[model samples]
Target: MPVPAKRRSSSKGRRGRANKGLAKKTLAKCSKCGKPTMPHHVCPFCGNYQGKEIIKSKVKKKAGSKK
Candidate 1:
C-alpha cells in the first residue's frame, strides 16, 4: 500500500471535515393532517400517505377502572 509522502496540514484536514457535517433534512407537509413529513413517505402522526390512509394508526385507548 502506498503511504502519504508528507503529514497532512491541520488546515487541510479541517477543510475536509467541514463538508462532512450533515445538512438539514427536507420535510413536506401532509395534505390531510397538515403535518411535516418526508416526501413520498407515510405520515407518522396520522398514518396517512398522499391524502389516503395506508396503515391504520395505533392510537392508545383510555384505560378504565376495572372493578
Candidate 2:
C-alpha cells in the first residue's frame, strides 16, 4: 500500500463529509388532501397517489339505535 506523504489527502476527506446538508430530503404535498408526503408515494392522509386513490379511509360510525 502506498502512503500519502502530502496534506491534500486530509482536506479531500473532509470535503465530502461537510456537504451532507446539500443532500437533504424534501417531502411533497398531496393535491387532494393538502398533506405532506414522500414523493412518488401514496398519501397516507387521504390515501391518494398519482391522481388515483390507492387506499380508502372509511370508518363506520356506530349509531346508538335502541331496538
Candidate 3:
C-alpha cells in the first residue's frame, strides 16, 4: 500500500474544483403547451410528451376545495 507524504492544501483542492460547478440544464419548449421543459421528457405542466398526452398530472384547485 502507498500513502501520501503530506496533507493536500485547500487552495489546490479548490483549484481542481473550480470547474466542478453544476451546469444549467438545457431546456426545450413543449410542443403542446409551448412551455420550457427538459428534452425527451413528459411536460410537467400539461402531462404531454412528443405532442401526445402521456402521464396524467394532478390538477390543483384554486382557493377552497370543492369536496
Question: What local lDDT score does residue 38 receive in model 3, on the 0 to 100 scale?
Answer: 95
Clashing pairs in 3: none
Best by TM-score: 1
Scored by lDDT, model 1 comes in at 0.80
The better candidate by TM-score, 1 or 2, is 1
lDDT of 3 by residue, 1-67 (tens): 9988997899999998998996899999999878899998899887899778887655423223557
Against the true structure, candidate 3 reaches a TM-score of 0.59
User: Can you list the residue pairs that collide in candidate 1?
Assistant: none
| Cα TM-score per model | 0.60, 0.49, 0.59
* C-alpha RMSD in Å of predicted model 1 compared with the true structure: 7.3
Better of 1 and 3 by TM-score: 1
True-structure RMSD for candidate 3: 6.9
By TM-score, rank the candidates, best first: 1, 3, 2
Can you give the lDDT of residue 16 in candidate 1?
94
Query: Could you tell me which residue pairs clash in candidate 2?
Result: none
- Taking the tens digit of each residue's C-alpha lDDT, what string does model 2 give over 14-64? 997788668667899998878888999988777789889888744111223
Better of 1 and 3 by lDDT: 3
lDDT of every model, 2 decimals: 0.80, 0.75, 0.82
lDDT tens digits by residue: candidate 1, 1-67: 9988998999999999998887899999989888798999998777889778897765312122333
